[model samples]
Target: MTDPELTELRELAAQGDRDAVDQLVELAGERGDFDELRSLAAAGSSDAVDVLVELAGERGDVAELRRLADAGNQDAAELLAELTDED
Candidate 1:
């Protein structure tokens, strides 16, 4: 993604465009851009939250998962539990 494209997507997303949000989420997930995904999740995108949870779990990022769980993300909580259970 180029800078201008990212900026454009951000602008569209900021304007309540669901398609833009979904596109951003998809791009962020593909790039493993956690910060972008987090921002989208914070903005109330459940798809972003789902992608964040999956990425964190795949990477075995306990801290990230914990943070998301503390933020009331049930999928993160469940993934955290599953990961810890393997210990």
Candidate 2:
């Protein structure tokens, strides 16, 4: 079940409340919502991009990381490099 607080935070984040967006990013990270994080990052949220890159790297999500890197996200590129280096 989704946490009530997260649901509320997501609602506020969707409305473009920066603080709420930041909170949602934190909560999403805690909940391991990689897809949501990726969506937020794609929407141009730098904070979300940071978290998304970290999570993607941790989860070994090469495709997602590659997508972000292709979009010129430096952090994603670095993380993807690190991940690929492990091969």
Candidate 3:
């Protein structure tokens, strides 16, 4: 994505815009930057949290999933349960 698009997405995402949050998640995923997603999730973006949970679960990142779950992410909690159950 261009710098302009990223700037715009950041502005909109800061306002909790769902579309902007989703776009940011996709961009971060494509760039393999789960840290950015984690940052966004920490800022209370449910969309970011969802994407982070999905990616962490797919990568079997138990630590990341557990952190999110401990932070009270319902999706993370659910996915963590499934992942642990599969063990």
Candidate 4:
């Protein structure tokens, strides 16, 4: 996502733009939906998995990253490992 578009989506999300939040998540993946993405792995939403994985990559939020990983989101799990590595 471009900086301006990303910024716009972030602002929209902060302003309660549910559609924008969904778009941000969908744009981050292939065939991924917004509602399912926010629900995480509980709903078997891989798109949500992909979105969360993408978010973890960008934000490096270890807790969310770990949760996604534990929930069996492979991409998210890998990203969490990379982001939270001891190195």
User: Can you give the TM-score per candidate against the true fold?
Assistant: 0.93, 0.79, 0.74, 0.51
Using lDDT, give the best candidate's number. 1
Q: Which ten residues in a row have the lowest lDDT in candidate 1?
A: 70-79
Predicted candidate 4 versus true structure: per-residue lDDT over 4-74, tens digit per residue: 98788768766767677567656645443434456433434444566767766777678877876786677
What is the C-alpha lDDT profile of model 1 across 3-67, one tens digit per residue?
99989999999999999999999999999999999999989999999999999999999999999
Best by TM-score: 1
Q: Candidate 2: which stretches are off by over 4 Å?
A: 1-4
* Backbone clash total, candidate 2: 0
Candidate 3: tens digits of C-alpha lDDT, residues 1-87: 789989999999889788888888888877768888887877777767778888898899989999989988888888889989999
Q: Would you list the rank order by lDDT, best first?
A: 1, 3, 2, 4
| Per-model CA lDDT versus the true structure | 0.96, 0.82, 0.85, 0.65
Candidate 2 clashing pairs, residues 3+ apart or interchain: none
lDDT of 2 by residue, 1-87 (tens): 357877887788788888988877787788888877877776667888888888888899999899989989898899889889989
